[model samples]
Target: MKGQGKRSICVSLVALTFASALAACSSNSSSGTQNGTAGTAAGTTADASKEHRTLTVEVFDRGKPGQPDLNNNFWTKYINDNFGKQFNATVNFVSVPRAQEVDKLNVLMASGQAPDISFTYTQGVVYNYVQQGGLAELDSVLKQYGPTLTKYLGDDVLKYGKFNGKQFSIPGKRTVLAGSNTFIRKDWLDKLGLPVPTTPEQFYDTMVAFKEKNPGNVSGVIPYGFSLQPSNPGLNYIPEAFKPSSLTEEQFATLQPQSIWLTNWNMPGFDKAVQYMNKMYNAGLISPNFATDKDGKLLDADISNGKVGAFQTNWDGPYRTAPGTYANLAKNVPGAQLIPIDPWQNDAGKHPKNVYSPNGMYIIIPKTSKNVDLAIQYLNWMADPKVTLFLQNGQEGVDYNMVNDVPKQTGTTNSGDKMMTVANNLDYDILSNGIELGDQQKNTAAISAGYPGYEKDVENALKVGMVDSYTTYYYSLPNAADAKSNTELKNLSAQMLAKLIVAKPAEVDSLYKTLVQQYMSQGGQAVQDEYIKNYKAQNGK
Candidate 1:
């Protein structure tokens, strides 16, 4: 719940771009991240060394671990020395926590202390700030200072950040994929002599059997672990299990009996999945406290210890701990492997399409800033691939080295400054950032180093996966009301389904009917209509 749309509560910020006329007056700033470094002498037309102005930036790594030191962060320092040396200006930096970012930004905007360049994510804050005229338009800036930027920001990338046909925000260089599929512990499946589960029913049976058997020096397993609690999007993974083949293209599609009004609870697969869950609960397969607890304690601690058999997670592996969940598990448990169970991975009846989302993370220029051009110039400098690589890894000889043109780390360095002391580093933000679809191959080495084919496996799964049905329609409702209503609807549906799982087969039908009525009353129909309208509008059909 906390990870879902809750960030919107603190997302009301001010934004607007300054007039285009000022862009011509602004000169390029030195690439130097510090106060007085010069930029590169020999560079492209947009080179910072040829221009002069101070650029301010806002990045998210204020107190976080594994970041650049304020003084030695390669990019910052490079800009300070190299860029400043060439252009005679320096870069100013601001840092904030990821969770409270929106709120902090809002406060800054209200206090009239907005930064020149700021990072704005979706969840209402960016749009709120833009609507309030607190952010700047970057069309002129991009045209004048960023011809390379113009080339990379293709049409698809430009569509999402547009509001009413005018572009207010530029998509960052990073692209984010949709939700994950069900990840099963392969070792448990092999121990139970079970094959990879292709259907929800088969998946349910495996979880049940795993709980019943209690193999591998562990007691009974927690069948089907999840982090879905109050108002969390993690529960979104559930509906996929019971999705009707006909509505596979549209999980939130209308079921064609508005007169009868069959809700999601009554859908063909809906009741069955819930009934299975209830059975698991009553039989002690599922933890009884699952409904009340959502911190993922049951999944993270219990499953990580090899006590739980199966859980829903992203393709990358245990989302709670990066690389640790998958890496450590494989290292500790013999034959431990992550298996992705697709709700529709093998369903030939449906054309698979993963969910597509607009860019949540963006770099923007606040309207209140004194030096808009300087900020844009700094961002432009950061966008360079060479700069990106430098930020991510470190200096060439110190942090990392190119062996046959492939970047390899010489030694581990936690801070960018420290890394820079040794070798050149990769700037993930600069190298792999994008608002649209990105080439996984570009970041292949880094992602693999950390996740080990996790990205590719997930993408392959998504090729046959189902995207969330609500993403497109979500924007129509008032921001607050939309988030709250969806959360409540999903929670009620989960609750009802959980109950039906335990009820007698005879009692299942009636329970499902009751759920249908409740769903309709909760504006499920209106929600469906919104999706249909938006989908058509997007396709121009």
Candidate 2:
């Protein structure tokens, strides 16, 4: 239940595991990643990179097999040589379990056992620390020591870290912010003589066609891939086209957020959206047991096995090679064509999807830390253009090669320093998310190259996902009601939503009403009301 608002805890795990999924929601992209290396090249502070004795930063133990140690690895050694020795400080990395980072960091900060620099994606963690006055105010330190850092992160991204005007965290800058994209089997469409779906009605008819035609010729064809997890991107977005577009600011603020955790049953068109989904489910247009595929493995497996005709997933998912959904599909089914499409549009004629906020992790320097100055200096150094480039692509011609001026990653290197386990070596470049070329065109080309043959598909997905996309809203103050009841309420939302989706047509409305009623009684109303209060109080602050 950590970080459910904006991008949920599941979304973070999606980034850590199926990085392709992160590509859709990320401005933390690959191209502009190196842009930070130049970091506007403005180190205006008198002693920006001053000498210090020691510095500590937290890194995630991503639990990937054969992955280098988070604390000490080739990348860490490179950092030590390039940045650490120059500052006369030994940079130490403290590893926190990725899946349990928020909980672990809470304990660490409370016990004064945290690193000099740490971060969390969970807003509740930041709120807890701010409430306890355990986080250092970074406003002055950033102005005095992190000019380039501030410029790169910009006002919009940095604002996410401010609470009541106190800058308690440094939000990592993400340059692009696209989100989920839906894909259809181009070959199936051709076989069935159906053009791409345009409206919600057309889209549903298309799914029905996908089922009735048996174009894939599989024993049990899955017209659409789905997962019932609260974090499901399709579950979060595909139906969002049904949300009313003319919501006033206050209503949007109160309801749009935390939709994944609390469910947007109260939203005007949400019930209709769920009812349509129930119709699809009863007709067997979706995976029969989608509820069991919490981690997306089973659904992904279905897609890779060439049984799923159409589906939605994090942008660039099918294009990537890791899980290689597209690759496996190509190998299994000859002439299978999976292409990105923005089919469902609301009455306003827009494909409403959730784009990422232009921020990544909320990095902090705890008040308990003695190395505040050094920590700020270290982070500032990280924002350096050259440093950002190194952290992202490693040595040119070793870790990567220049293709049309883009750094193309060459697999594992002979030396450890140039090698990487995670794609884009995101672990090493904690400050940046995906690749960043100088501009969108270059960025698209760079990302396209990463996907090999599916370059066009990747580009299409990115473009389609961005059309009329709404960036996740960040609250300046945390909702205590949400933080307190989110765990219980999130599970309830997921359970009831599954029932609403799978129930008979006649039961859909009654089930949805029950969901909203039970949700309100079981702490939903408190969360909603407290969130509104916080939103109104912090409206223009």
Candidate 3:
């Protein structure tokens, strides 16, 4: 299976001039009918004028247990009114659970019920579909119908969509590229006369002090709050400090998980990290129910109730914004102060974090779709700057007001919750050219409007330069072993890590070794071998 050779083939192409190609193509005409013939163009116009084609789009549904309908909300009607009427197309959105996107799309594709446009963050899912010929080749389709999208995404970014010399999908561009960082309660530190930690030992000591002193209303305070859930595990970045630099070419290629390459539990420093976590658990410094708080609700509540002293979260959400952990905590516990800090120093004594890929989601057309051109047209329309603004901020006067040329959201509801009511348009905003990238002054003003006087905190948090995780290259090639074994390996790793953190101090080392060996034997070795082979071939090493 090592020399199956499916992974060895590479595609290299000179940048095709999009403007000339687009200028030559007939306007609003689908792929094959681009030539201006009276019969073809007239016939297409007549058909479109009489009856509009139906386009089904897959969007992420993130409603709570008993909230309003996520799919059929105000944004659905907005899309129908604005896009459908303009394009002579009827728009329908299919809701896929955000957490179970891969599983649900697999079922839909298998049953020939997949939408015209489907998207995923996982590279393997798209690879699997392309390998099975389940995706539509978008190069010709895009050239004929997607001038706006081509112009917006450009040639360099679109290269990410190419596989085996064909464009199988459109790669969404990411506006930001920094991993999550640790945040601590500055008020607590001040109350206890403690300074912010800069090293691993200092961080450990701080947690111990927080546990012992109980700075703010000491009773029931958790020094460190974390969750072991697969999706958003707590303290996920702690082990990076212990990561070993010396690695073989193969080891480096397969070192970290897909979309994450800066650090890994399989590396040398993981044992020490786990042991430190175990020590915290034993000393009651970490939350007691961390192993079972899979969805992070408990931790969220703890942070809000002023029970958590420190936690790790994405740069923007938890620290610098409102309707978030910091905002909620401030409302519940007066004078709560949260500050972002890059305190994890690796073996090299430097703060290193994973660099986010510029690619956000892989948007694809299904082979079974009847209206591929219409789908491409819809995406192109969305890539328009005005449309992107409207989708992101809603009606200017109603949902937001322009301040310093930035659309700052208005009303009592904060930006985070307001997004849900607006059909979470950001998810369906396939182009991802939101206000975050458009205007710096407006972006800062909008963030400040959300969480008054915290714009500087958000700005400071973005100052840390991130290191590349190399996920772009990893996602380009197919890894057969990963398709077969990555899920199991991740599950095993999460479970074992939890066990290692809560086990007896003496049992920690043995537990780590046993789990690592088990992980390798179960399928990690095969996955690593395939990645190593692909990396060497791609890099000509």
Candidate 4:
């Protein structure tokens, strides 16, 4: 294979160059193993006599203003001390800003400076790379060097990596697949003598009542705080109830059921959803100037300061982890409480919510990489049970201690922060998507451990068993039309949605129609046609 030849050349070059430089750094060190071969354990040994090749992996920076040195974090050192040394490889961690991932990666690829192993959560980006033939075929590489990874991920999950019957990437396995839901102030509901909302009408009435009677004594409360920013449009689930129960065969063929921006807005009930949002805006039921909350700081502040009555968030977000929204709100408002509610009842009188896809981000090796074999070896090592346990849970004594075979965090004042500083570098874990323990019971228990007080809520969420989007199966495939016009169409759609939400009641209908027409003309139609073709070809529909 091309990767094998490259690996040989790379190893020879590195050995020749580093022979003198690393003369004192022998494989006999404490980190080294007897045979100098990578082990399944967390701390394994590597051949010190062999020169170590440098392999770079990309990680998301997450844009913390003052937190620099993402490339040299504790986790980076941990990997270097353990995995890198064990494989006779010097792993270089490259930090790509989370917000500018696509743009930065595009530039890196163009400049031939992309990391050996890169990943992205956006399927469109993966499709674009595959279409451009910029990614290496991984089937042979996995067979040659990734037996452990193959065994761990299994064929069913690995199918997500196949494009055009060739493996161009590896799909990460997600353990918990629950999506976002609406969380409301339970204390306010009790104070106002109201029941939990199950219908759209009931939800709207509840928000209005929250505005009318401020239960928490906080002035200027946002009844339904939402972020209208392009990236974090928090209102996607609110409008799901308005979606058509079923699509026409042609519409179904043309649309991707999972896409919130592309085909979702084009659905039958979308116009009504926008109209409903506009009504909420007119009534001051939603946050004013929501479009300006680009990073969700305002929403977070509102939730923390007891100024938000209700909002949608991940199932474990509000209450889970330290300094949590639920904890903060509780401190500020003496009796504040939060609980999840499925507020959108569909036409059939059943509450419908989006469920997360079982597969997660794609991990791929660029064709330009010189260390493809090293990258595969690193991922395979990461899939090992001991190594995975360390990366996900942290050092046994310092971060967590096993209780009845389940790891639990030790009670330390800064334990959460300490664990977060090291374990939050999720981009490092390239194999398992979510927290995987290789046991369903243990995996569920591990996930619940993160949320201290919301065990039942988390359990109930897993039981929801909502429907996933149609695009779940097509994530690894490329959509040429989308690659060309997705960004433009996304910006246009966001602007139009923002306008419709705040537009005068009389002007909304006309504006929405105009926006949809513009969207269809400006590449949306092309995208739909391409999706229809791909869907039929893939599903034999």
Best by lDDT: 2
Identify the runs in model 2 with alpha carbons over 4 angstroms from their true place.
1-41, 44-52, 67-72, 230-234, 259-262, 413-418
In candidate 1, what are the lDDT values of residues 1-541, reduced to their tens digit?
Answer: 2232222222323344334322212223323343222233222234445445555555565454565554335466565665454445666556556567777777766566555666666535666766677677767766676655555556555555565455566666434444445677777778778898776567767776877776555765576665445444323445445455455434433332111011244345655555655666676766556765656555566666666666655434463343356655655676776666655332334323234343445566676666665555555555555655555555677666765444566665654444432112222243234221134443443443433346555444443334432233233212433343565665675566445655776677787778677776786656556555654554465
> Each prediction's TM-score against the native?
0.74, 0.87, 0.76, 0.77
Between prediction 1 and prediction 3, which has the larger lDDT?
A: 3
The Cα local distance difference test for each model comes to 0.52, 0.72, 0.67, 0.68
Residue 29 displacement (Å), model 3: 21
> Tens-digit lDDT track for model 2 on 271-361?
8778877888998999997887777778888998888988877677787666788889899888998888887788788877777888887
In the range 74-169, model 3's lDDT, one tens digit per residue, is 455566666666677767777788868877877777666777888977666777777777788999888887877887778767877877668998
Candidate 3, pairs of clashing residues: none
Candidate rank order under lDDT? 2, 4, 3, 1
Best TM-score among the predictions, by candidate number = 2
- Pitting candidate 2 against candidate 4, the one with the higher TM-score is 2
Which lDDT value does model 2 have at 509? 78
- What TM-score does structure 4 among the candidates reach? 0.77
- RMSD of candidates 1 onward, in order: 6.5, 7.2, 9.1, 8.3
Model 4: per-residue Cα lDDT over 448-484, one tens digit each: 6667777766765555424332233333445667667
Instruction: Estimate candidate 1's alpha-carbon lDDT, on a 0 to 1 scale.
Output: 0.52
Candidate 4's C-alpha runs over 4 A off are 1-116, 122-125, 212-214, 248-253, 261-263, 291-294, 320-324, 368-374, 410-425, 452-475, 503-507, 537-541
